[model samples]
Target: MTAMRSPFRDALTTALLLTAAVAIVAAIGTQLSGGTQRIIIDAMIKMIIVLGMYIFVGNSGLLSFGHIGFLGLGAYTAAWLTIPPSIKASLMPGLPDFLATAALHPLPAALAGGAAASLAALLVGIPLTRLAGVAASIGTFAMLVVFYAIFSNWTSVTGGQGSLYGLPVFTSLPVAAGFTVATILGAAMYQASASGFRLRGSREDAVAAQASGIDIRRERLIAFVISAFFVGVAGALYAHFLQVVVAREFYLKLTFITVAMLVIGGMRSLSGAVAGTAFVAFLSEVLRQAERGIDLGVVSIGGRLGLQEVGLAIAMLIVLIFRPRGITGGRELTLGWRSR
Candidate 1:
């Protein structure tokens, strides 16, 4: 018989299922109120970011606390390119003459964001990917801190913690859904490709992979740049979705949530990325509603301001304790039977 197509088949199934879930969310959002649709967009954006993280962290077996820095990079680049020149001149006068005067469509803005993030990743990955284990993770975390500081304090360029508003609201449910699907397909393809295989081999045993002629750093850096670009796309989408760009929005808070989603979903497989994002996003929405007080026919419960964070923390802890492999147990989704 010909070589079995299990892996590729499984990857396609996983991508399709992931796309299906996003489509369902988009459909449901269209049927619901505007606020609900906004929530769906937010969730899909998170899905894209988490999937982007998986493209590197999952394949390379590296924990990155710094991809959110790429998110900030993408967000700011999109703001610079896409925001109206008049608004840019008034709010971000520190922007370069070219950027301040340039206004672009959403596609170009997103591409610019991705390119900027990928460039940053290329520079950082050279040094960072050289390290291994916890050291690499810490280095990435430091990167995030550096980005946060710059964006927070760069008054002219980033609005200095003030929200940069008037971004053209271009990310509707369809746009968000399309981005999510593209991210899923891109990640799945990379995961099943030769580079992904070599990277995973390096991840499992760097010494062996190195002995086998695989340049560990090169592979890791490739994944890093690719992942950064995808996350940057998510950031651009987010900027347009909210019609604003704020430093704090792309900082630690979001970093924590995206990381949690990945961990709870399973960092080993693409399906885990999708499952984790959907699970956490749905849970988050529920907790948000609960915090705002859900009305049970007979009684109106008062809102609990911090419940969302508290619930997330508790859920993460429980999942870590019970299912450290995540909801998908690090397994890829498959269309046909997948023999153990």
Candidate 2:
């Protein structure tokens, strides 16, 4: 007799596959050079961020260009909580009394950062979520611009354009892999939940969903907050991973790469998010290595400037042209023996 298929079963299968793949990569990355390990960390971080994105964009069928703003908020909030009081005083003397004096552990700081981003999302989503289609996308983009402008000029708090340093480097490959696994599980559970299904239904047809009594705004806002919490956690991890924070790191270039990852991986599925992240990460690492010079005894490739961006853009264009739904074609990964 065959066991009955359920959302939990499907989620478990997908989560296990994603976790296993990342764990394997982590094990292999441990044997590689420091530079290569850094690449792996970068990839895992992108996985976290993209999965957070999948929670929102994948289920809602909405494109958000401003989620990076939440990422920045989380990073800075975590930085404020974790940096030493003395360093904080020097860099951001204008911090509130509590923030200026309170130096917390990484775990607390990460939690606080996630909470901060979720709060920001709630406030922003209230109005932005009310809009739909291009207008909604523009509203979110505007929010990102607002975040950038504020962080860029808020020298007393954000250090303006300067890099904020002295953060503890605690995000090892294993640590990142652990987070990636958790993120994968969380994304899968959410995607299989009733809320996720309703949001997707609304995405399919707003009018029909509304006629069915589904509150689109509420669903979108819920997703927005949940996604922000994870993205914010990714930011905290990123801050500790790099031991630095800069407003610019959460800006346009980062946004483009992350969004591209989602689009290329198949924004509709959790597997797509993971695959896209790994694919783009591998391509990016190779391109960067080539830019440094890849020697092949007889001849060498790379040592060229600006090739990484050019290569990535070309690859993305090719994928879009040929596989517009992305590498996974918007389908979830499943074991052949498992029930669909």
Candidate 3:
């Protein structure tokens, strides 16, 4: 018989391995051209977002189409806190006294962004967590729509539909990699915790979990808030990276892509989350290059607009057909020495 490892040991091993892998990628990115580096940084940010979604969807078997809304909230919050006072005053004159005059650093702004998202998640999760299955999923989508509408129309706070710029560009390869490692560790630890177990139990069998004294709603709520915070932080990083915040960017397209990454990688496992994000990001980048037209020695091919989206759709369909459980099959990446 194989011996079972402690949760802490398992989590630590997984975190260490993932961190090393990310570090290697980041290192390579530093030597690449500017465009490639941007792709790597963007992928790292997406990893954070996917991992955040995994915290809730993986453990609770709940699908949330609205988590990207938290990302938007985080981005806007960061913009509000970090944009220069003069810029804020002119660009968003409807701002309150404090936000108009405030110009905090990116680090603190990122934290505040996460806090804002978490608070919003808590407020929405109160009623949302009570729902189950498709209902819960739909509820979350509604939440996203509501956030999009508010951000698009609330000129005073969110600058309405206009893009909010002037954020310091602080999210480089190192910065994104650092946050990605932290997110990986946080996700692994959370998955190995008691709450994670309870949540998973409920996911597998809600009645049995409730009978065993698990408060389903509370567990879901906890995961929801924690997940929001992570995605929110990713949002802040994204804002700093692009130095701009746009409500449309956080809407349907992003929501679909991020959720697809989680699903294609296996939403049930953290390893799957990372794997899926990396796979899709690489594939998307390749398709983007193709869309711009690739030149070969004999024949030239490319210049296909919407190739990225179409390619992603086809890839997702293929994965669903052959590997419905995702590339990882809902399993964590582990050393061969361990036995399940």
- Which segments of candidate 3 are over 4 A away from where they belong? 1-5, 337-340
Candidate 3 lDDT, 41-74, residue by residue in tens: 9999999999999999999999899999999999
lDDT of 2 at 132: 92
Query: Each prediction's Cα lDDT score?
Result: 0.90, 0.89, 0.92
The predicted structure with the larger lDDT, 1 or 2, is 1
For model 3, what is the C-alpha lDDT against the true structure? Answer: 0.92
- Identify the superior model by TM-score, candidate 1 or candidate 3: 3
Question: Which lDDT tens digits does candidate 2 get at residues 51-142?
Answer: 99999999998899998998898899889988998999999978998998988888778878889999999999999889999998889899
Better of 2 and 3 by TM-score: 3
> How close to the true structure is residue 33 of candidate 3, measured as C-alpha lDDT?
100
Candidate 2, residue 57: CA error in Å?
Answer: 0.3
* C-alpha root-mean-square deviation, each candidate: 1.6, 2.0, 1.7
Each prediction's total of clashing residue pairs, residues at least 3 apart in sequence or on different chains, is: 0, 0, 0
Model 3 lDDT, residue 317, Cα = 92
Candidate ranking (TM-score, best to worst) = 3, 1, 2
Question: Which runs of model 2 end up more than 4 angstroms from their true locations?
Answer: 1-5, 337-340
